[model samples]
Target: MDSANSKITVLYEAPQPEEYLQLRAQTGLSLKSLDGAKIGLANSIFAVILRQEDKLIGMGRIIGDGGCFYQVVDIAVDPAQQGQGLGKLIMNEITTYLDIHAPKGAYISLLADVPADQLYKQFGFDYTQPKSLGMYRLIAL
Candidate 1:
């Protein structure tokens, strides 16, 4: 099936925790422990994409302290449905939410993986260099 022409719908809703795990694995994103996923998702604002038959194809989420910081995370698309502008659709919904709900001077951020940074640049995200850098440390279970 040609995903480009297939009817795709982007919904401003969170995927089920199980669906979130499946989509993350399919898209090669880091796997989240089920217990962790449950807690994290409960605090996130999400956008989910569905293909023709209601197949979950993509999703993105904003997780943060709600008032001061917001990080865009879990942007993923089914491998078969990629290159069909689904990522853009996901970002459009995310940014729309930010524009409406983010407080003035709020810090919105995302960690784009390699070439995916190009996609995010279109949404006005720029590198924070010469002043601050993005970093993280994974907790061992």
Candidate 2:
């Protein structure tokens, strides 16, 4: 849809923790504790999203130590906005930031959720299998 008609805009701004939580829930991403979200979002290097009619339609963020490690995280789009390329729009902004800022030899990584990995591959992300595997644990609250 055309901008004049859709009024969708992408911005390089981090959503407030509440907005982030809402988008995560709407987009089927796992929920985060409010306290954890505050610390995590405070440390994010970059975030981008699409907004339509003042509603957050999609969002993504880069979080890590500035130089050595960066993890692409919290990539999400409103269910109604999926298939509209909003996810790619989010990734393009994120990778552009990385190209400009990440140091040479810096390790950038993400844990893609099943089929979503296919979307990431288009942007040069590869499976780490055989060489390494992604692992994680959820702390009991």
Q: Please, what are the lDDT tens digits per residue for candidate 2 over residues 1-141? A: 334348688888888888889999987888888888888888889988788888888889998999999999999988987887778888998999999999999999999998899999999999999899888999864
User: Which parts of model 1 are misplaced by more than 4 Å?
Assistant: 1-6
Q: What is the C-alpha lDDT profile of model 1 across 1-141, one tens digit per residue?
A: 345457666676777788889999998888788888888888785555555567788888998888899999998988987887878888888998999999999999999898899999999999998699889999865
Q: Candidate 2: where is the Cα deviation over 4 Å?
A: 1-5
Model 2 residue 40 distance off true place after TM-score fit, in angstroms: 1.3
Candidate 2, residue 88: how far the Cα is off, in Å: 0.8
**Weakest 10 consecutive residues of candidate 1 by summed lDDT:** 1-10
Residue pairs that clash (backbone atoms under 3 angstroms), model 1? none
